[model samples]
Target: MVFQIAISFSQSIYFPPSNSSVWDTLSISRLGWCPDKVNDFYNYLDEQQTKSFILLKDGKIVLEKYFGSFTKDSLWIWYSAGKSLHSVLIGIAQEKGDLNINLKTSDYLGKGWTSLPPEKEDLITVRHQLTMTSGLNELAFFCVEPGCLIYKADAGTRWAYHNGPYDLLKDVLESASQQNINVFTTLQLKIKIGMSSGIWIQVPPNHYFLSTARDMARFGLLMQNKMVWNGNPVLRDTAYYNAMISSSQELNPSYGYLWWLNGKQSHIKPSGPSSVPGPISPHAPEDIFTAGGAMGQFVSVSRNTGLIMIRQGLSASDDLSGLDLHDLIWERIMDLGCITSNSASQKKESIHLYPNPSQRYISVDIPNTSPIEAKIYDLQGRLIQKSFDPKIDLKGFSKGIYIIAVTDKSNNLIKIQKIILQ
Candidate 1:
């Protein structure tokens, strides 16, 4: 019953804000949903043992709530999501001219490190360590043997989600930057991006991180803008940004350098030492990427839509409790202009376009035309052209893939089509 409702709710749901931050007493309503929608989502979280959720859109706080002891200043563990932080540090290290990603890990860690009888030390590269395909077995994390984590398959030959391989990534960054991970993150990223306040680390009894839901949102937004904060390019490498979002392994096409790509044709490997049995849809996009952690902690970003969303929860693997809450939260944010869907069904059926992939000349087709409006945008979501008419020539348009969307009288989703002008 829970699963059925979850599927249905995910299919169609929207949230509309009842109050405004522009004023006060801001209350958002979930369109096409009942007040119990939020309650139901919360109930589901309770069932799955979730903790907190923070949803943001357009760099504004839309939904911020917590459960149990959670609060506006509470910081939860990011778990494996920490790996992404490590990955970003690598990029920063490169920007600062520390170490190159193509270099061998042994170069910094020294020549004596090896688990492979005697001949595999030179096979591991920084790329292998970042992608978790360094040929190290899952057991390497636990093996106390001299070089258990350093032996076996050669770099790039095998793909495994082993901590032993990725754990070294932190070491590489520290070695390259000549500073600890925390200090580097603070000075290079956190402080630069104005996120130094939300940083923390666990030293046995204390939590590893201290951040509010909004802080996570900021982090997600930074990724959405390709590591640009406040109009400044903090990352400095669009190529690394592209690589960060691109698939890193054949085993899981959804897995990028250290981030998780949604909507990709990929599956999780079920080989060995994994919590999940098979690859599962994270209900995202091939262009969408995220930082996911144990339980339900998430920082999802969509470069296409320019969206940043954050969620924090505590649950077992593949659990749907906290996820339901997140779904409802998303629905509300969508209504508030935080998320967008570019589907034909969401638009009017009366709008049309001609010369789908024209070199220069094209026409805008509208039925009973209510002053059909249209705008063209590139894959990077940049607006290049705009027209309002029944037939407008595209002699001035550039040659590239573009999205031509026409809005109707209601200002809702209208006709949106892909135009390739060669």
Candidate 2:
């Protein structure tokens, strides 16, 4: 458990009035960004149906753009991105002695919250739910009922991304704190960080936090400073804060507690635990951690560069992980030739496969490696074949989904890419 120390900010760090609309902003030209490229970026955002976009450097707004009828004060849903907010609230609850994350979740939700037997269910802890390793059937996904929360594996053994387990976190917070989640949010977090406008609204199976884009920026700024707002300690627990931002488990090094981390050696998505060989946003800073949601809602914080970005939009892609939108934005921003805060982003190893969804044969390209050995596994994790080279012939295999696990000479996983045979 690595603890984080607060970063002391100079007077240049600006904080807005707690109840006012006034904010300090820095010009793009002053930041040495190409004026034409900055406008083109706004055009790209508009073309992508972005409702709002906010960029901050050193706590001062750099660029804030709103599209269509969405004004600066318009409220938008954070969708799954709201999970990061709960992550912070959970830390606060622990800090106040209201709950211990290691305790059995059943201690608060009461026994038989899931269909699993008490002995097996007792194996789950609040931390398991926080990290999305609850071992609950991800097929149950949005269903939070007891019968839907059946056992899939022992807790902490498998890592799966699903919302049913995460949704219960609100209940845990409400139960442990003995207060309504909204009330707790306002008192413990929202007001403390000048983000009082945000509210959790239930839209059936899933609950979302609705707030303005600037309000989202406020939260991101708070996180960028390691949970401090203008030197005011919003979440004073340094250990929990560090743990929340750091990798929570090994199954997905790209994930923290409801937050997506960049620069991990490997990453997996909602598709499954088939690891991909790079950070989610290859064009972004390695220290950029993200909280993203369905469609295109996200808050990305660059711990190394003091950059905080919030984007709210609609995406046509079925990527619930929001990886596509996050990467697209960074790809364009990095191409702007304005900032080189993290130049090492250019050298990250990203996996590429040729003619994906092929029926006969496939070739893999993994940069800066030799003798790219691969293991082909079925959906049930049964190893079907092994290849000494980077090519795989799917002649005898049926048309279905498969996982190609790339490993080092020692058989340790270096990458795993899910491919389709058709």
User: Which candidate leads in TM-score?
Assistant: 2
Candidate 2, residues 276-371, lDDT tens digits: the string is 876687656667889998888989988665678899989887777688789889767644433222322232136566677788788877676655
**lDDT of all predictions, in order shown?**
0.59, 0.80
lDDT of 1 by residue, 233-289 (tens): 789888987888788867667577877665554445323334342223332322557
Error of 1 at 142 (Å): 5.7
* Candidate 1, RMSD to the unseen true structure: 10.2
Q: Which runs of model 1 end up more than 4 angstroms from their true locations?
A: 1-35, 142-146, 196-210, 269-282, 318-422
Lowest lDDT block of 10, candidate 1: 1-10
Q: Give candidate 1's TM-score.
A: 0.66
- Summed backbone clashes in each candidate are 14, 0
Model 2, residue pairs in steric clash: none
